[model samples]
Target: MITRSVQTVQTNPDDIIDIRQKIAGSWQEILSQAVTNPQELLDILGLDQALLPGAVVGSQQFQLQVPHTYIARIRKGDPNDPLLRQVLPIGEEMVITPGFSFDPLGEKPKNSHRGILHKYQGRLLLMPTQLCGVNCRFCFRRHFPYEENTLNREEWLSAFDYIRSDTSVTEVILSGGDPLALNDNRLAWVVEELAKIPHLRRLRIHTRFPVVIPQRITKELLNWLTGTRLQPVMVIHCNHPDEVDADVADAMKLLRDHGVQLLNQSALLKGVNDDADVLIELSERLFSCGVMPYYLHLLDKVQGAAHFEVDEQRARQIMSGMSDQCSGYLIPRLARENAGASGKVVIAPLYSLKI
Candidate 1:
């Protein structure tokens, strides 16, 4: 069983504020403040040996990195831990493969405008920031050229101009390392600029901060999100249900109360949340907190993440098991992203054939 630290609270949103204020000065800051070096992060979590092994002193040392906020949420000394599986780097495979180029998804080639990726029609993904609270081991964009993609003030203006130029593009997705990592002032500024584009209908933010650092969902952040003219959508990256705690649930409630749609996109990792029961429980917990389970993505064929890949057959079986137990809404669509494909390819169940 996955063990977690629990806290109780009343239904009132003010009560949530009271809880946060009480812990504001004392509470640990994970990504933005506490964690600095990769090795020191390991010592804090007491995961130096289990994850690193003999490679600790070698030229290529395997490191155990977890944000203090994330570490605070974990039940200590559980090897089967899901959250640990995401951040702890194990010495498994090091050799690089041919097809796993820096730009596996062809993001750079498809960029029509600076700070914008126009892969799909009717929408443009604007990489507002190139920083995330915590870096996932299986990130497909681990090697993405962030230096080339960072947008300056004039560059952002040009991106907005491109959005206004094309009426077909109705949605603007604010993504990056994590959009919420930006302070309220910067986030509000970007939103204000996007609001001027008359053609944009929906504004979506893809972030992992709410799951990793729940304290980031401040009242000021919610005010800007709801105050916008375009419909606001937040897609949170959460691989395991254990990552969602009372703090995270409170954050989601704040957004839901102020008319922001909440959705989750989970990645299927071999040792992390590949089990059927874990996936089912994740869906149930997400629904209870008003966040819809959207997609269970297969691990992208990234070079460093080859250790996290489960075979295609095993993945399909897990999906089938989930379908039998949960409602269709709770069961997320199982899919994979093929390089240069028009859209995400859904993985269908296998059928037996006899000749």
Candidate 2:
């Protein structure tokens, strides 16, 4: 229905394949061009107008942002498309579900430094920016007070001081809206600073950029990522197999080829990837891309995202099924983040219950 003059190809005249254009331009340019309008997204996907009302309301609460590269992967006109379900603003987000709070992980109390979250024992999290390529509707930090946590160049010194004082800290995690959201120069400076600390041994980045905008993994980005002495580990968030395509595969290969370890962490969302078969395929896809399955997180109980949560029992059952179908290395550990916990709590599968 909608056509654009980009480097994409469209075949299968009966299917909605017009949006499949090659995504070019700088990552920043593509990021700036993300589709924020609910109507525009509906038009591009050939979705019905009836869903617009809910989308408008949901976007009002948490602005809708999805990159064209990611949008092209969703099955047009399919409201329940797994890829679409993750980003599509829906009325259910406005509901006040019980037990779902604005701060599910109690991160505010853990904000030890200007932009640092020292929740775990040996590692700390730094938030340099509050930007992401795509804003998933089920984000636990949807209501996070990013303003209080974001740090400028000078402000980072205080965080560095905090880490320097704590010799026990051996790893630093770059997290936020997504650390990759920051430009290479900024990210390089941050990594360089972390590498200066004699105690820091590894630098982990948690981001969704590779899935949303694979082009984010540019040569300059690779230079900073691999140049650092601290071991680089990228934990990418990908829920469904549909999110991985040729572009994403290439990006992952680049990171791996450059000696940057690649790992995937997925959320056990209700409609997005609840079935055993879907999770199995996702793990296989990730392995083929040179990434190992790491964590299958039980959805964080954040306000407005209760609809996405899968119960602990069901999560364990799904893990059991994955263990049965896939190799041990391909199966991710089932984990959850409890407030004030020492570290991520791993949930044992149902089959392991008898043992």
Candidate 3:
């Protein structure tokens, strides 16, 4: 009798086309050393040892999750580093602020079926996995009970049945703790199933992998992604310009070269990207790297992340400034994800078009 581990999901090397032959096995090495423990993360970034206890408490449930690829981008010994601010499990995260609830987006009510989040019309979100490559403290779904929603083989069939019955679902969005966390074979299967629905015309993947772990953009992944029938669009998340390095630019280029449209959305974190100058730099850097600015999101008021919030008035001012200097295409929509709202509630509209 033979047994297999969950990590070792058997995938055929033949199914992996062109590029996979050249660079076959390297992600595992990166994954093995990904920052999971509190002390290792602090030591690597040269953050103060005194901050560890608070981080441990804050990350007790969610825990510290960061990739070595991402850590290298952070300025070592700087507690106030923007990249560190995004991932560091500080003591402030332990203090639950008022009016902040667990499910900030109200996704629980919108989950129409298992493994499905039908929030907006025409497009619905699918959870291929409940895990993210790097778990940011400010994630809207930090408190999402993904264990209950994790689908098995049989549950996946029911999810398929629900989608097949509804012709209105023309687009299937792969959202998760991060959809790109799933292996190429598993993700290919999910996309293939979505393509089977005749009404589905677009496949949108909401992930942070290309920013945090550029290595994730391998030939095998692209092969599975490009092989799909559904038109592919990847919405990558990047809050700061510094996150985009040469390697990241190359990864985005590969995706763009392969015909995948790339767009980016950023959270308006209080420390990370609040200033107009920082936001401007972020937009400029993103464009240079072939990624268009999609949305400059107002922070979601989740329980453990209130410290990162910037006032709506300040947020509009930043957008207004970006409007004044940058091209219209460079400016992103100022949107907020309000619970029970049909779509993203547009707080500040884009600048009026000049004919």
Candidate 4:
């Protein structure tokens, strides 16, 4: 197997619980202290030996990344837990499916601007950082050439100037490798620069930081978030209700309290949140936590995550069933981003304006 050796986690009981106590105060320290090792995650959860080798192999291709706050929610010893399934790297990831490719959404061709991606008209995606708080196993951008896109001070200034010249671009989206992974000062600087552009009407941030590491919702992060002149919108991602514990809810609520419009998008993953019941629960939970359901994304056909994809027919069925049980606002649009498409095509059947 083409894999690098992972440092073993010292499973002595004190060391296990000690890190948890130490990470209590600061989200910066918590992010700095995310658990990247597969064995350390397994040891903490008390998982069995049967799952180890596959996890080790998969981690090499896309390293296992889950913050302690997110891990604490998983039910110990249950391999099928929704949260675990999303983060755990299993043997199935090694298979190269016929249809799946490195650039599933055709993003490589859309690299028209430095550190900027123009997929849909009127909006551009700015990737200030190629880092994330938690590296989700099924992420479509798993193979993204982020290293090449890492823009320095002058490059970013050039990119910002590029945005200023594009009169048609009205929305600036901050995506990543989860954009919120950047420190408050760094993100603030970018926001301040972007706010000067007169054409931009909205500053949309697509992130998973608040959910994975609730402590990431610090006051310094909020200062720029609220201070920005552009209309601030946050698109958070969460696959299952279990992922939204009390801490996650509080973090989201902090954003809500600060006037950041909260919206959520989730990928429809097999064995994770495919069930109608699960979808319904997730929607209701999301609404209670101050987020409106935005998109139920059909899995982006990317390599290593074909196992997680649910077919279009089945996806529609699940959405239909969810519509029957959930309130209209809670029912997210079932959307797919076909390569080279102008926008996400909504295919969720029987979806009407009326609840």
lDDT of 3: 0.84
TM-score of 1: 0.88
The lDDT for every candidate, in the order shown, is 0.77, 0.88, 0.84, 0.87
- Candidate 1 — which residues are off by over 4 angstroms? 1-15, 24-30, 48-50, 53-65, 349-355
List, residue by residue over 40-133, the lDDT tens digit for candidate 2: 9999999999999999999999999998888999999999999999999999999999899999998888986788889999998988889999
Ten-residue segment with the worst summed lDDT in candidate 4?
Answer: 12-21
Q: Which is the winner by lDDT between candidate 1 and candidate 2?
A: 2
TM-score to true structure, per model: 0.88, 0.92, 0.91, 0.92
Candidate 4 has an lDDT of 0.87
Candidate 4: residue 97 Cα off by (Å): 0.4
Clashing pairs in 3: none
Of candidate 2, the 10-residue stretch with the lowest lDDT total is 13-22
Poorest lDDT segment (10 consecutive residues) of candidate 3: 13-22
Q: Which one wins by lDDT: 3 or 4?
A: 4
Candidate 4 C-alpha error for residue 221, in Å: 1.0
Q: Which candidate leads the pack in lDDT?
A: 2
Model 1, residue 310: displacement in angstroms?
1.9
- Model 3: runs farther than 4 Å from truth? 1-25, 350-355
